[model samples]
Target: MKLETTHASADVASEVVFEAKGLKKEYDDGRVHALRGVNFRITQGEFVVILGPSGCGKTTLLQMLGALAEPSAGILHYRGKSLADLADPASYRAREIGIIFQAFHLLPTFTAVENVQMPMFETDRPAAERTERAVELLKLVALGHRLDHFPSKLSGGEKQRVAIARSLANGPTVLLADEPTGNLDSENSKKILELIIRLRREQNMTLVLVTHDLNIARMATRTIEMKDGLIVADQQVPQTAA
Candidate 1:
C-alpha cells in the first residue's frame, strides 16, 4: 500500500513525529487498565504536554511513545514508520529517542562530560571526537565549565543539565521527558522548563513532556489532558513566532 504524502508548505513543520492509535494497556487480567485506547500525534518541533492527575496513564503513554515500554494493543508510528519494524529497539532508543526522568539518572562516579559521553562509548567514534562532542553538548546546556564536576558536586538544576546534555549526545529526533521538573524547587523548575523550551526551539526537537503542573502544561504549544486511561482534552495553544 502506498502511503499518502501531503505536501506541507515550507513554513509548516512535519505533520507528526509520532502517531498513536487505539493504544490500550491492561495489567492483572483486566483489573487495571493503564491506558484505554489513547490516541495522539506529536508534530515536529512542537512542544507537547501530557497533563493529568496521578495514575492517569500520562507517564505510561509517554513511555510507549518513547519505545521504552510496549503497549498491549495499539499502533505506534514514529516518523511515519511502525516502531515494530526496528530491528533492535535498544539501538533505536539510543539513536532516536532521548528520555529524561524526575531523577537526574547521572552516573555518580563519572564527571559531567563522562556521563554525557557514556551513550556514545560503544560507537567507533574516536576518543577525541567523543570528548569534543561531549564538550559541545555541555556548552549547549550551559555546562561547559562543569565538565569535570561529578553529580555529587552539582546542585539539583546542574545535575539535570548534565542529564539534558547526555540526552542530546546522539541528536535524537524525539525527546520524551517524564515529570522532568517534579524534583526541583520553583526556581530550578523554571530554569529546567526554560532549558527544555530552548532545546525544542533551537534544536527543532519533537518534545513530549508529562507533568502535573498546569503552569508547565501552559508552556507547551499543545496541551493534552488524560484521565481514567483516556484523553479528556487535546488542544493546540498559541506559541510565540519562531
Candidate 2:
C-alpha cells in the first residue's frame, strides 16, 4: 500500500501513531534555527525513513518525535493526543516508545540478557517473567546463543542485536532508530537493516529511521529528505512485486 500526504492530517483516525505540525526548533540563543516550521505524520505499522546530510536537524527532529527533546514550537500528537497534554512524558516514553542509538549503548558490565531485562525493572512484571521475555526477545534477534555474553565479547553486529532486543523488551508501538547501522561493516549493516525490516513486518510496528545511507533509506516504504532543518522532499517509492 502507498502512503499519502493526508497521512499526517489532523482528521486522521485516532489510531494514527504520530503527527507533527508546524514544528520548529532553535538553539544558540536563536543564532541557529534547527527546524523551520517542519511538519509530518506517521501512521501505525508504517516504516518512514528520514534522510539528510550533516547538520540538517534529523537527529533533533527524531529526538523531538521520540519525546527525548521538546520542540521549541509546534504540536506533536501521539495516539491522537498532544504530547503536551500527557501528564507524564517519561512514563509515556517508557510505555510506548523504543529508542535505538548508533552506539548500541549497552552496559559494559551487564551481559546481553541483563541488558535486555533492564527495562523490566521499571515495570511491575515478575522477575521470572521478565527473564523469559528477555530471552524470547534475544532469540527473536538471533542472539539467544549469546545471552550471557558481555558487550565486549560480542561482535559489533551482535551488540546491536542485543540492543534491538533490549528496545523490544517493552513491546513499544513506535520504534525510533538513529543510524543503527552506522558502525557496522557493509555485510553486518545489511543484516541489521534486514533484521529491522523483518521485525517491523512481524510486529506491524511504526518505525521512524534516521540515516545518511541512501541504500538504507531506499529500504523504507517512504523517504523524507531534510535539508537545512526542513523537509525538502517527501516521496513514496514504488514497492517491488512479490
Candidate 2 residues 1-242, lDDT tens each? 21112133334323678888999999988899999888888877778899999899999999988888788889989887888678888877776778889999999999999999987787888999989888888988889799999999999999999999888878776789999999999999999989988887666677899999999877787889999999999887666510
Clashing pairs in 2: none
lDDT (CA) per prediction: 0.83, 0.84
Error of 1 at 209 (Å): 0.5
Candidate of highest lDDT = 2
The window of 10 residues in a row where model 1 has the poorest summed lDDT is 1-10
Candidate 1 CA-lDDT value: 0.83
Q: Candidate 2 — what's its lDDT?
A: 0.84
lDDT string for model 1 (169-209, tens) is 77776789999999999999999889988886766777889
List the lowest-lDDT window of 10 residues for candidate 2. Answer: 1-10
Give the C-alpha miss distance for residue 34 in model 1, angstroms: 0.5
